[model samples]
Target: MTPFWKLSAAGFAATAIAYGPARMGFGLFLPEFRSVFSISLQAAGFISSLGFFGFFVGLLISQFLTARRGPRPPIVLGLAAATTGMSLVAVASNLTVLSLGVLLAMLSAGFSWTPFSDAINRQVEERLRPVSLSLVSTGTGLGIVAAGAAALLMSIGGVSWRLCWALFAVGSAFALLCNWIALSGAGEASGVRRPLRWQALFRRATTPIFAIGLCYGVTSTVYISFAADRIAQAGGVPGLPANLSGSLVFICYGAFGLLGLVTGQIKTLTGLPWLLRLLLLASALSSVLIALAPASWAGVVVSAGLQGINVMMTSAVLAFWSDRLFPAFPSRGFTAVLLAVATGSVLGPVAAGSFASHFGVTAMFLATAALAASAALAIRSGYISETPHPE
Candidate 1:
């Protein structure tokens, strides 16, 4: 395979495991998990918050590891962490074990995501880099679709959650081996490594983008964590079985994955600035749809599809922005945005769940819609710029 395709293929599979199963699977499996563990909504939210805490810790340390040893070691270590973490979750006996498993799995996304930019920058030709990276990102959608499909089967066949986690782990292990070989073939950087710098973390241009990421962190995480439960509570697709909402999460993911394939083309058409703006608006609309879906079953399906596309667009655009801002130190830019994302992810569920415990999910989503609109305004008002400014 061509080098660009090699890395793209590897990155795609790894992301599916890292983001789809190891990390995002928590939200997808919340119903079965909470029932099996007798977890309260607040407890579930707290667990999700704890996972992001692990993600934050990993995000902090990955750059240090990457700075000293390039991107290869950390990527491999992350895949290992994911594989072990999912295995642990599959057989977990208590809430503590499950949380630990989730934490480890969540760590995988942090470890795997940043290095790819550096890798692609190294391996893929400049002209093909954007398209290649976009293609790799669709892996998250694929992972989501896979997870959703698994859940669909489980819902249909009455399979155990234990099986779900085990399958996710087994698949991750296979993907890990492929990712390791692919990354290894990309070869290590040859020059003396640049010393990790603190100043670049605070460049003026990154601030707005980081804030936008923060909004995504808060709203999107909450939606992922609680939206399904909300659908179930609201009586789930009106005509369909209530138990199938979990399965539908996969459908949403499938839609996301399929739509995500066009990210490169979409970026090429809209360009970054307009694309970011449109995504913010699209996000706001999606949130509104989620908030209102209880009244109309058709809205549930539409909301899920929109959410999938909006998220892929946002993540793709963010990755593009990070690479543009920090050509040599792309990881640092990614690190900054991730830290922002981590903070929002950490806080989002805790706050949204607490508010939901009082005002309910509908209210929570409307509040999120407000935040998404604020993000759009922030972008429109010049917090995020189209051009990269030198540090």
Candidate 2:
């Protein structure tokens, strides 16, 4: 394989290994943490939110660093941080220490993502960008599956959750090694340049892009934070088995990513707006089903699968639109959306957790469904337009 494809594959592997076990698995393990530590649900939510907040901080910092230094250094730093973070989590004794570990892990994950994505966008040909990115995004789903399997394995072995974390730490180290080997000699070929100003980058993206960012942030946050919990509640599954629920959620996510890969080609053959509309509608419908599904495991699985398809489709659409809108600065433009995503991620868990505490998990799912519906409408209303290009 060519170096570029190899890099993309390595990036996919790294992302799946890091985020699946570290970030998304946190939710799978949340009930355990809450039970073991005797913490309030809100406190548990805040702990997860803290990690997301760290991701936001990391992304903001990465924007400047990547613009100036290119992607390699940040990527390396991110991998190291992730390794350290997960290792710390393996031995954390208290809520505070666990939260600290989560924060660091998320920061590292965000750092890795921003620079790696920036590198991919800069290096890949325009025509192949969407499929490449969709492939990369699919890594999250793969990671989720792997984490679920790991959790199940731990359960069978009668091992503590801490040992699972140690496994993740070991896996992250391997991923880091792979990243180093793949990226070696790649950076020197591209000359280093001075970092661009954040203000200038923002000016170029305009309000529409920012709106898109905001929309994405809100929708994704809601989905990621609540999808599994909603499944547990809706399916009448107990909290102990929620990791299985998360595994189901990721299965849907991965399946939809594959769908996005197939549908992305339609955009090349037909038009962008049609595909966007289809994805938006799918998102809306999935939200509705998730909110309204009867309390059964089967319902939860179906709902999660639908929502996954919607999310993966939206991901492709966003990537395609960002490239068109900010052709000159794809990394900066994409980062703006990613920042919004991180912000939403931080807010989503807090809001859902609080609502679930006060009202119930059902109410939380309904609220998330409403937000998804609203986002779908916003995309359909023609408020957002693809930048016209010369054919």
Candidate 3:
């Protein structure tokens, strides 16, 4: 593989590894945390939501910092913060400390992920960018699988969840070290320019992009937040032995990345909007399947896989759209999309959790399916049409 490919792969791996513990692993460890901290379920959920909140704040900060200093410093700083945060969580004994740790970890993750993506977008050739991005996204799946395996192993070894987090922290530190080495000589000096106001970009193509992004974000957030729990519940998998469920979720995500590659090629062959519609339909169908699945492991796995494909396809398609819409400002456009993702992440979990708390997991799945369906309609109606540049 070429140096760019190697860097992309390394970057992807770092992202996946860092987020595995912070995002997916946290849910797996939630029960154990509750026991240790003596917190209520609602409180625990609130704490997890705090991480997302921090992520939002971090993204905003990253935009300004990256604009001024370019992306490297924030990326490095974010990775360092995430490493420390995860370590703090591993040793945290109180709810306040744990919450703070999670917050910091998420903030670091957001900072690292966005700037790294910006760097990749800046450095890589245009045509190869999507493939490289899809490859990078595969890291998320890999990390989730690793987290699940770790959870299972820890359970089998009679180790505490805290210990698992500590181990994950050690791994994250190693990942951070590797990223530092790989990216050390890769930093760019910021070009001198007047900083553009956020509103300048926001007011231009902002409404439609954010509108579409909101729908996409909500769907993604809901799916990620509750997919594992739903699978475990549906499959009757024990909470402690969560390997199969976690692995299944990650596998689904990986499959989705593969699907993204395939679909991206198809978009090149056919058209992007058409491909997006297909993804939306798939996502909607996946949700319904999850909602109606029998209490069997196979049913859960199948649903998870479908959800994975749906999400990956949606992301890939939207990314293509962003590239087309904002050819001059890929990072800014992508960040706009991410802002929507963050919004969805915030709303999805809270909404799903509410539905789960009041009704059941199935209802949450159904609601998410509706959201996916609505987004498909929005795309079809040309709410996200590309504007023609002045002749």
Candidate 4:
């Protein structure tokens, strides 16, 4: 196998474990966590917020490590965090331990993503870099699919949630092993590392990228944290148990997320502006579908599917976009974009939880849909460049 293929495969597995079972799984299992821990929606939101905050911390650390050392250290460190964090979640007997585990696990996502930009730039041919990044981003959905399937089967078999988390830890460990082997003897950073230039980092040309990131963070976090709970409360689809229905939503999410591998092709055909508009619209529609028909199995499944596609595609777009915008500092610039996203993530759950307490989850989802729609309108209003910024 070629180096690009090897790195892509290992990167895919690393992202799958870090984002899927380790990071996103908390929301997937939120209902059960609530039941066991006897926490309220508000508390759950707080925990979710804490996890995103941890992601913010991880991103900062990752940028530093990736800039100074290389992609290997941060990537390996992230998988190790996934393995350890999920293990703690698996065996936690108290809410405090669970929260700590979740924070550590979510941190892996921050660590896991940005370094790949550096790796791709270092390892792959320039023309193939975007494709590799998109493929790696698609791993997020596959991981979700795997975790959701496991949860569904376990739910049916009456297995313990703890056991499910333990299995997740095992998967994380395997991902760690894959990355360790794949990244062996990887090249470290070369030359004198320059500090980030905030002026270049915060250009008017990049406004839309940061805006989209923030909006995506809010909307996606809200959906991931609450959509399943809302579906369960709506009694799920008829003829199926609520838990199964929820799991199926994520399955649809992960399965259709595979479609994001085509994002580079789509961007080539449609250009970045149109792609951003379309993705934002899909995100809006995903939330609107749930807001309008949470109880409809078809509605929820389609909603999850659209969200999965939008998320994966948008991530790929952001990866290449930032890489192009800051060719000299691919990982650093990408970290800035991710930090914006993480900031929104940090605020989304807590705010949504509070809003849901007042208006209702459906209402909160509608509000989120509106936010996404407004972002799409912003794109249509010439807020973004039709093509990528020059290197």
How well does each candidate superpose onto the true structure, as a TM-score?
A: 0.91, 0.85, 0.85, 0.94
RMSD of each: 2.3, 3.6, 3.4, 1.9
* Per-residue C-alpha lDDT of model 3 across residues 186-267, encoded as one tens digit per residue: 5674576645534545654446667767776667656655565555555544443443454455555544445555766787
Error of 2 at 150 (Å): 2.1
Once all C-alphas are superposed, what RMSD does model 2 give against the true structure? 3.6
Q: Name model 1 segments beyond 4 Å from true.
A: 125-128, 257-274, 381-383
Clashing pairs in 4: none
Model 3 global lDDT (CA atoms, 0 to 1): 0.67
lDDT by residue for model 4 (261-290), tens: 888899999888888889989999999998
- The better-scoring model by lDDT among 3 and 4 is 4
lDDT of 2 at 296: 52
| Per-residue lDDT of candidate 2, residues 304-386 (tens digit) | 66666666666666766776766666777778777777777788778777877998766766777677566555654355556
Question: Judged by TM-score, which candidate is best?
Answer: 4
lDDT of 4 at 79: 91
**lDDT per residue as tens, model 1, 1-391:** 8889888988888888888878778888887787789887888888888888878888887777777766777788888999999999999899999999999999888888777777888888999987777767778877887887887787778888789889999998988898878888656654686676758667676777888888888877887887777766667776566666755865674566476566668878976667777777777777788788743666777777777777876786777777677666667777887889889999998888788778877888899888888877766545556465455
- Runs in model 4 deviating more than 4 A are 125-131, 386-391
